[model samples]
Target: MPTLRDIMTPGLVTVDPQATLKEVATLMLEQDIGAVLVMDGEHPSGIITDRDIVVRAVAYGHDYGTAVTDYTTGSVFTMEADTDVQQAAREMADRQLRRLPVTEGGRVVGMVSLGDLAVRTGGSADETALQGVSQPSADPQ
Candidate 1:
């Protein structure tokens, strides 16, 4: 069983909380990622997913220039880099989350997603957790 530090994406894709939704969306698309950390300097303040843009900003008729903070998930869940991958998977399953920031000494170091877990440790449990995360959500964001 790998630690999160072994399998997590080893860098953060971040956006300033004050950035426009358009800017963040472009970055996500260019990076081919599903989520971006909303950073306040080196501190992570929130997260913004593609679902957040479509559900919160688009559905609400907010324009592209809208601040990312207006629709970003304000409270993010994180895991320590040393955490066991299975335990991290359980936390994500319980929260119905697809991504978690990986931290070291309380500083953001990387991110882990359902795909990362599944690919690094292929097993029934990881498969199930990934399926659960991939399921459509009514709340979207």
Candidate 2:
């Protein structure tokens, strides 16, 4: 089984909690990533995703200049870099999350996404299972 360390995208883009939402948005766009890990010192504090920008900010009419920490989901779900990809996938599914931060010794090292796991596993087991059931039944005659 592949480990998160093998599939995680290292050198992940991170933002400080005190940074403005606009600054975070610019960083996301520039990095071409959908989410960013928010750090306080060396520890991962929260995460800000594109959906947060829409639902937590624009949809609610919150000002973009406001600090990102105001809108970020501070209760982060994380996995160790050496954790099995299957375990990470299960955790993400259970938590209904698309991404998870990879950490080592309380320090953020990288990030892993559902897409990355799917690719690394040569397509998800769930997908393969669904495909198996979706296939046509054999003729009874």
**Top candidate by lDDT:** 1
lDDT by residue for model 2 over 1-141, one digit each (tens)?
Answer: 778899889998988889988999899889999998899988878899988888889887889899999888888988889898777776776566677899998788998876776676787633533343344546410
Candidate 2 wrongly placed segments (more than 4 Å): 125-141
Encode model 1's per-residue lDDT on 1-141: one tens digit a residue.
589898889878898888999999999889999899999988889999999899888888889998999888877889899998888888887778888899999999999887787677876347656766767776853
> What are the lDDT scores of the predictions, listed in order?
0.85, 0.80
lDDT of 2 at 82: 89
Using all chains and alpha carbons, the TM-scores for the candidates as numbered come to 0.89, 0.86
Best by TM-score: 1
Candidate 1 has its poorest 10 consecutive residues by lDDT at 123-132
